[model samples]
Target chain A: MLIHFHVNGKACAVDAAPDEKLLDTLREKLQITSVKRGCENGDCGACTVLLDGRPVASCIFLTVKARNHSIQTIEAFGEPGHLHPLQEKFRAHGAFQCGFCAPGVTLSAISLLNQNPTPTEEEVRRAISGNLCRCSGYVQIVEAIMDYVEERRAAREEL
Target chain B: MAAMIYPHDSCGVSGATSVFLKVDSDGSAVLYSGLSDVGQGSKTALSQLAAEILGIPMDKITFIAGDTHTTPYDEGTGASRTTFFCGHCVKEACEKARTQLFEAAGRMLGVPSPEKFYIQDGVIYLKTFPECHVSVAEAAHASERIYGHPILASATFSSFSTPADPETGHALMFERHTFGTQIAEVDVDIDTGEIDVLKLAAVHSCGTVINPNLVEGQIYGGVHMGLGQALMEEMLEREDGSVVSNTFSEYHILTAADMPGVMLSGMVERPVEDGPFGAGGMSEGAPSPTAPAVGNAVADALGIRFTSLPLTPERILTALKAKQSSQRS
Candidate 1:
């Protein structure tokens, strides 16, 4: 089956195998390198990406189901000189090491923030519960996202 | 960028994925580096070192660490090697530039040994002459012209390993190894036999603290893995060594609900007589204390020593039954 969708705001088309995981299409065919390989069974959210602006583990998603949805990979988040505030906050707050799980973490945090612009620390942890970080523990990652939420909330109040 | 000063507006937006630095004809310097963003804050830490050495603001540096073929060779950034090793090389490269600042100052001053010369705020000055303040790029260019050369120094650093004695496991390489302690607190449900990690505490000494936030994260990650090994995750096999419990339904990791409050504590970062930044590796701690910490915690909670990992409900009940029989005997 041929499927067309918006990936990172760009139109994308791919031939789909019904049972193929969305992760295979993005990493193997499209060559978006940010979504990493950890546990293929989706236990580790290392392969998380945004599906229609919500975070989902690409490893478990069926490629055929992505027909008209919006997908976002780490490559689309931002680049040098133009970074998403979450990435900046993560860096400033020291939210990563080895960085194997960074892309997934970044996506998961963004997903949480998208659903609830103002989230408590516990909420943030629950939102990112599916993902596993092999380094930096989860303390800093949680701190980084919490910092972003607080700062964003303050900025929103100013507006 | 290496010394990126992220505006609050771009809080979640990560861009400019690369960096580098350059020196102008004047006394200004710039840095370029790929922002691998190792989460140890290599870019910020490296820029701090450059600014410390080159007498420039950390923001004056730029970096590019993302596109591997374009920027430089990084082995995907693992094993806690970024700070002690990579930062050492970056510092040395800046020193090479510092050397030129001295050489230029030396030729004009007719002074000896600019190696000891100091620069502050992009102004080269001799401690011997407090009145003389000169721009760095000016001095560098002048020295290049007078000495008939251009000085652009680049460096790549490789991390080394230890020479440990096979018998005793004692050795020396990059300073010394780090030691960490993990304590687990758990409670097993009598009916369900589900073990719960009530609390986890870890104390680690991985040399100097480059970033406390990063260190805390490392501790949390380690304890979480320990939690998984204790109650949920297992690489199980059949009696014939065939695979079972192969999927997420069986092989489990800790969820937010399964975790307890983590307490991070420890110290061990003062530099020995040797070492890059007096820092050691952190990779080992994530897996080392995990099993033991949870094992001891399970014992504390259940009053039974676990002979094997992953104290699943069935296993706990079995052990409990055995304990009951022994008590009756």
Candidate 2:
């Protein structure tokens, strides 16, 4: 089967097996290394990606089902020289240590801020609850998200 | 609380060195080592040490590590010894390279004593006559031209070895000891037998914080692992010894929602005698005290002691029922 979708603001087309996971297509076919394969099941959010502006685990999601949907990976953010605000904040706050789970966590946070721009600390915790980071407990990660939100608000107020 | 000391066994023989320094004609240097990062930030810490000792900017140093074909033998990265043991090797290697650089700079500057010269920001200069100087690139080029090889130096380090006593099986086991104390506050529901950790506070000493951010990250991760052991993590096996609970859903780890509301941590920066830059190993020792602290807190909350791991709801209820039945009897 041939499937066409938009990835990271670019149109992409790939031939897919009916049972092939989106994670495989993105990593193997398209060469997007950010969509890591942590757990094949939906338990670990390491393979999370945005489908139609909402976060979903790509490892469990079939590529055939993603036709016409907009898929977003960490690459949608900034690259090496140009970093997204979330990535910048994450680095500044030391949110990630091993950085294996950073892509999924960052996307989940993007989805969170997209829905609720100003969330409480508890809300922030719940937003990224699905992603798992073995290194750097969720303390700094949550703080980074909260700090980004606060900084955005302050910037908006100045405007 | 029972007093216990668990000997750290993994990092005993761990070692790494800048086996070679290939100084390009441009003065840039590439350092080779076998220490693998594995996300513990050993690369950054070791690189910082090298940069400090070499008197070169961090950008000027390229660290090559974790490949057997390119790097030397390392005991591997575990036991929290990368920064302590491997760092010592890096320090020594950089010092050796520094000496070579000074020697070359002395001959070029016509100085009899190389000690009278110093290197800063990759530039070697006379301390007495600051006007006369040679860049590290120039020094390397001059040394290679005169000595017929690139400027290279290497060093290996091993901590003091204490032979174990055969009778009691105890020796001066570890090269250095890292100490930590953690306090956990939990809320236990009497009716539901649920335990919710409200806060966690950890005060630890790993000796002379190399990177404060990285150290704090290790502490946070350690507490999370300890929470898993204390509350909900378990590995189950059947009669034939086949494993169950193999997946993340079955074998649960702490999530953001499960995290405590407040995490308070502090460090005691007491430098160890033989450690590199007076630093000791930390990550492995961070989780040691957490389970006991949380268990004690739960006992304080419920007025009963539960001896098994995970402290599951069913276990808590079973312990409560046994207590009640005993009181009735």
Candidate 3:
């Protein structure tokens, strides 16, 4: 089957199996190694990606369902030497350890910040509830997000 | 079941690790080692050690880790030994390079003795005449040009020794020992048997802290893993030996919402004479006491004693019901 989707702001068309998951299409076909395959049941959230601005687990999301939709991965956020605010904060705060779950966790944070630019600590925790990080214990992850939110708000006030 | 605290210590054993250092003519250094950084920040921590000892900025050092063909042998990156064992090797290698650079710099400046010179921030200067100095790049270039070899040094560390007592095995089982304590505060519902951990406090003594941020990151990660083992994680096997609960959804780990409301951590820095920068192994120690601490907290909440793991709602409800029935009878 042929599926057409915009990945990382680039138009991509690939041939995939009928039962192939979007994770496979992204990783195997498009060679987006950042979309890891931690748990194929949409549980670990290691393969989270933005589908039309909503975070979805790519492991269970079928490639066929993503036709004509805009998909985003961690690669879309920032390039080498240029990092997104969330990525920058995550690095600064030491929010990641093993980094196996980084791309998914980063995308989930992006989704949360996109919807609610300003979120309380509890709200931030709830927003990333679906994503599981085993390495950093989520403390620094939450702190990084909160710091990013505060910095953005401060920038807005200056404007 | 009893609201008792269990205190324990574990030995850290690291054996025969090697690190290779090569100083380029440009004053930059490359470190090659078999240690792998599985998100534990060994690269950053090890590089920091090299930079600090070599008197160069961290960015001036490049680390090549876990390469079999290029790097030397390592026992692997577990048992919290990367920082303790590999750290010593990296430090020694860098120290050797520093000594070599000082020797070359002394000759370049026409100084009689290398002791008259000291290095700071990649510059080797004479104590008496500070203005007469040589950059690390210049020293390396002069040494390689004269000696006909790149400035290179390597060190291997083997701290583990064989146990003397054959039966009891009492002879220095580990190279170092680390101590820690973890306390968990939980809110339990008698009816639903649900437990919500409100907060957690962890106090650890892991010798010297190389990086405070990395240490805290390790503690948080360790606590989270311990929570999973205490309240939710389990591996089930059938009568035929078929395993279940193999997936993350079925084998649940703590999510962001499930984490404690507050997590506080503290460190005690008692430098070990042999440890790198007075730092001992701490990565594995963080998860050791969390489960028991949470268990004891649950026992405190309910006077009833439950000796099983996970403290799942089903088990908690069953225990409560048993207690009620026994009371009625």
Candidate 4:
């Protein structure tokens, strides 16, 4: 099946198998390695990708179901020398260790911020509950996201 | 809860790890080691050790993990020995390469003795005359081209331990040990047997900490793992060799929603001898005390002692019912 989708804001068409997951289509076909293959049963959330700006587990999502959808991966978040503020916050806060689950967690956090920019700590925790990070225990990760939110609030107040 | 871990093989035998350090012409260094960083940041910590000895920025050092063709033989990372044993190996290799680099810089600066030179930010300067300096890159280039000796070294750090006595089974199983203490506070509902860990505080004396951020991260992560072991994280199996709850959804790890609201962590640096920059193994010890601490908290909350792991609701409810029945009878 040839599926047409916009990935990272770029129109791409991939010849994917009917049974292939969106994770396979993005990683194997589109050459996007940020979406990791972890717990392919959609429990770990390591393969989270944004479908129409909402986070979804790409591993269980069928590639054919993604036709005409606007998908976003971590590659769309930032690039070298020009990191997203969340990435910068993650670095400053030491939010990750091995970082296998970082991309999906970051995407989940991004989706949360997009929906609720001023979420409470509990909301932040609930938002990223789908992603599993074996390292850092989600302490620094939550701190980073909250810090990012505070910075954004401060910046907006100043503006 | 308090605990101590020996930084060696538990069977009263020495453990070993190896590393190869190569300083390039650009003053950049690459550390090839068979030891890998499995989310504990051992490679970064090792690179920090090398960079500190070589007087180069950490960014200038590239760490390659477990390359069979390039890296030397290592026993791998375990028992929190990566920083303790492999770290010493990295320091030894860096020191050897630093000696060669200083000698090359001494020759380039017209100094008689390499000991008279000091390195700072990849620049080697004469201690007597500070203005007389040479870049490590320049000296390394000259050492490779003109002197025919590139600054590179390989080191193997090994620990020795005496086997247990044949009669009493008493022996020095480790030369160094890491100690930690953890406190866990939990809220348990007597009816539902649901446990909610309210807070976790941990303090560790793991000699000199190589990286404080990574150490704290390990403590937090350890608490999560410990919490799972205490309250959840069980492998269920059906009869006739069938496995259930094998996936993450069924086999639950600590998620953000399940995390305790307050996590307090601290480090105690004693700086033991023979360690790389007086650092000790802290990663493995981080999770040791957590399970016991949570268990003690649960025991304190409910006036009963549960022996087995994963104090699930069913077990807790059964224990409570049994206690009630015993009291009534």
> Tens-digit lDDT track for model 3 on A1-159?
888889989998899888989999988888898999887888888899999989999999999999999999998898679999789999999999888888888888888888989989898888788788889889999989989999999999999
Candidate 3 CAPRI category: high
Task: Give the distance in Å from residue B64's predicted Cα in candidate 4 to where it truly belongs.
Answer: 1.7
What's the distance in Å from true for residue A55, model 2? 0.4
Query: What is the clash count for each candidate, in the order shown?
Result: 50, 0, 3, 0
TM-score of every candidate:
0.74, 0.95, 0.95, 0.95
Question: Higher-DockQ candidate among 3 and 4?
Answer: 3
| Cα-lDDT of candidate 4 | 0.86
Question: For residues A1-159, what per-residue lDDT tens digits would candidate 2 score against the true structure?
Answer: 999999988998899999999999999999998999998889989999999879999999999999998999988877898999989999998889889899999999999899999999999899899998888779999989999999999998999
Tell me, per candidate, how large a share of the native contacts it keeps: 0.57, 0.72, 0.91, 0.86
Greater-lDDT candidate between 1 and 4: 4
Interface RMSD of 1: 2.9
What are the per-residue Cα lDDT tens digits for candidate 4 across B10-32?
A: 22364667789899999999999
Candidate 4 TM-score, true structure as reference: 0.95
Q: Can you give the lDDT of residue B303 in candidate 1?
A: 83
C-alpha RMSD of candidate 2: 2.1
Candidate 3 DockQ vs. native: 0.87
Docking quality (DockQ) for each candidate? 0.36, 0.83, 0.87, 0.83
Those runs of model 2 whose alpha carbons end farther than 4 Å from true positions after fitting are B1-19, B146-149, B165-170
List, residue by residue over B1-329, the lDDT tens digit for candidate 2.
Answer: 22123333244532333355566667877878888887778877878888888778889889898997988777777767677777887888888877888888888888858788888888998998889999988988888887566678777766454667799877665666778888888898878888898989988887888888888988899889988999988998989998798999889898999999999888889896677789778888788888898899988877887778998888898899998999999
